[model samples]
Target: MNENFKLLNKKIKILHLIQHMKIGGGQKALTNIISSTSISFEHVVVSTFNQYESELNKLNSSFIDCEKKNILKIIREEAPDIIHYHWWPGFKMIPKNKIPHNCGIIVTVQDPTPVEDIQADIYISGSNFINLFQKHIDGKKRIVIKSYIDVREFTLKKKKNTEIIIGRHSTIYKNKIPENYIKTLLDFSLKAKFIIAGDGESKIIEKLNLEIIKNNAQNKIEIWPGEKIKEMLSICDIFLYITPDDSFEGFANVISEAMVAGIPVIAENKGGNSEQIIHGKTGFLCTGYNEARDFCQLLIEDRILRLKMGGNSKKRGLTFDHTIMGKQYDQIYTNLVKLNNKEKQ
Candidate 1:
């Protein structure tokens, strides 16, 4: 830890209110923040759902399972210096009058357009798109804090593979997958192996599998569980991500993770995807599937180009390192506490 970071270690207690501890971008982001932040700050994570209780225990902070206890009771019991909500639904219905006067409320907007009516002392957005979208909200200090991950965990020694691999991983919602997703994979099936990893609705999974079978691409495309994200990234040479034209991503963590693993990405030029990829340098952003296919084919044919872009991608990905994000968050928490104390006095 830097000596400057230690100055902000005032043992401030932060109570994180989240919807669940599931394996999603928001949950992972929260865990990374808790793990990377200075140990001087105390953390207590309160989850409305307890699907992955074991994962919550892995964090350095304490955990509160709201399934078994009341959130209001837990908040009063913790009486933290800061009450930080990870997403909108987490703090939606909580009464403002019930909270302690000295406690500061911080809401990190994980989605592009979250419910703006929710009151908070500070509103943190993960991307500029979200920050700008919510700029009209009244009476709150808004700031942009990009999401981060533990870059060290993604650093993997590459091994030689028989075929060029293109991969993408996500929670796999209908809107998250492009409409012509199967056709796009079939186009590249002869040249590269495709790996789509993630858990989603059974209907979506069934539809994807049926399409693969219908197109006789069962052997070319492989669908893996979301838990094997690290393994998938290690074997993949290129990261290809595409979502529907109408759908938008707040800040796709998978793209950053793939980049950190030294994989060049070719993502759809929509939402925050444009912000993550530096076109023609780190990776190419496509306006449509045809453009994405061209970019993917370009990298597939030129191994040297792939390596060069991958190196650039890794360099750019380091900007979202956990330590850097942790420092920024530490400063934010420190400032909020100071402001709250001044008002209280």
Candidate 2:
């Protein structure tokens, strides 16, 4: 709502590039931004992987196709005021002839590697964590912009005795650590049900019969696979994420979502996660698997602490609401356009 941003109010078309719109943190961030903000500008997101067309359309997609000609044709017809790229790998495939499509490109860097070297008019990193690593390609505008959430989705909810760890089971990194979270929960002699709310883990999950152990004690671990997470997150008391050396986590939308759901989050004590949940306020942060286990134990026993932290988490969630993010990006876009015009003259 600044003067610079008002200049872009004439429905400027923006072309966004994405690897895919699957159920992942990165794609969700992109989807939320496009969906929540007021459409002051025309926008199209060309996902390389042709998934989630309906969701994209629900978010008001001007054009949702993922073909090469379709991409250029849409751009040529819309004549987008600026083409923004949020992906990395697909750029290599862009024919050199279509370089004009990207002549005024803006890319949002989700990580801190080779993506930093790519040419762009304005390079926006989702959080300072990624942008702080290396300076932008000299002279190109680089800024740290954090993703926002729909705080209305998350409010202070009373704690439920049912504890949950919201993540996948398969896919562990170096050090031969337990790759699957279901395995970790199964390893413990827990008294509460551990719900696995995502897919892939179910394949390996069935092989290990955790039900027998739960049946013996009249307690259980539930595997509710696939993406029906609204009630799961809303009712769950605790949420945890354990990963190693993941370079592409700028602002995990799940963290924002969980915060809105008023779940006390426990995550690895590194990277951009520090920006998400305030340590000991909204959530707790610890290093190593054992430390994470200890944190869960602490939350389970302390109801007052859990309720207080969950409320704080929801409060923090509102700070990142998408309206704020779009306004910030609008000003940055205006800056890029003015800079482009100044150079042209």
Candidate 3:
């Protein structure tokens, strides 16, 4: 549709709420979403925490930071048609009295929080498990819409001769240690270079004999951490997405990115990852942290199989795209708006 036509149809003001629009891919993806969706829809971001211009510009999002105001004043000023929340901390801050009575609520549940009891008029989850649990929701309009990305920006490159890469910096959950994965790579001792890309609390530099190439010493994991995310995706032959979370991972954006990049992945068979990556086809599921290195070795030895799986991953990732996700949100918003109007009448 043309820009003028889209604007002329009905411009619904969307107040997107997030805890912190910084740090992780989930947050970044949300930012990207608002930017892309805002072209057709009226959107305003309500970030509970920091709202950096640098970060906002990356996603092409404009907004009002929620930290400065009492709930009443903020809601009144924005006068949002709907409150589409992404993070839980921000959801808690939504005052009941301040909430617009006529406006319907639609929430995108990304991760399982410590929070319980609080509800949305329309609840959406990123995976099927969350969707199934929606039957228990008080609201009738619960749904699931995966957090998908623009696959075009992350086209699968026939990997540049198996230089496998991993983002291993700033580790959060130790149980899902990349050290176990590192050991797996070391065991193979293949000609293909294996690199850890993320900065971590672990003393990784001292442990690995490999030189930490200066991308930036501050983050530590020896990376060329450029703004261009797709370049990193394009070069990697296999991606290691081994974050071992037992209870929750609403969705694995990086795993999906790797798949979009068409790199074979090895993700732990836990949390939402099991749903994100199809076993044997998109990636492998490591049941043991102890055996991570063994799996790495297996891949290093097998070239043709690795490429075939990588090819499959790319094909699967296309199914998860922003266009599909956006349309689902469009339907939800349209339904919510209609429902709210009916209630008013």
Q: Model 3 over residues 1-345: C-alpha lDDT tens digits?
A: 644334336777777777765456556567656654635567777775553567676655566766776555666777777777775533564543347544667667766543233456767777775555456566555667887877777774544543445433222334334454444544445445554543222354344424332222223233333344566666776677665344455676767777887777886776677777888877788876555555566666787887888889888988778778877677677667767667877
Query: Between the candidate structures 2 and 3, which one is better when assessed by lDDT?
Result: 2
Clashes by residue pair, model 2: 148-320, 149-320, 154-260, 169-180
lDDT of 1 at 225: 86
Candidate 1 lDDT over residue span 108-209, tens digit each: 887887645456788888888777778676635788888878899888777689999889998887768877688777875448889999987778878888
Off by over 4 Å in 2: 1-9, 68-74, 88-98, 101-103, 156-178, 199-219, 244-248, 341-345
Best by TM-score: 1
Candidate 3 at 148: error in angstroms?
0.8
Ranking by lDDT: 1, 2, 3
Kindly report the root-mean-square deviation of model 3 from the true structure over all alpha carbons.
4.8
| Deviating ranges (above 4 Å) for candidate 3 | 1-9, 35-38, 48-60, 89-101, 131-136, 156-159, 162-192, 198-221, 224-228, 244-247
- Angstrom error of the Cα, residue 219, model 2: value is 5.2
Q: Candidate 3 lDDT (Cα, whole model)?
A: 0.62
TM per prediction: 0.91, 0.82, 0.80
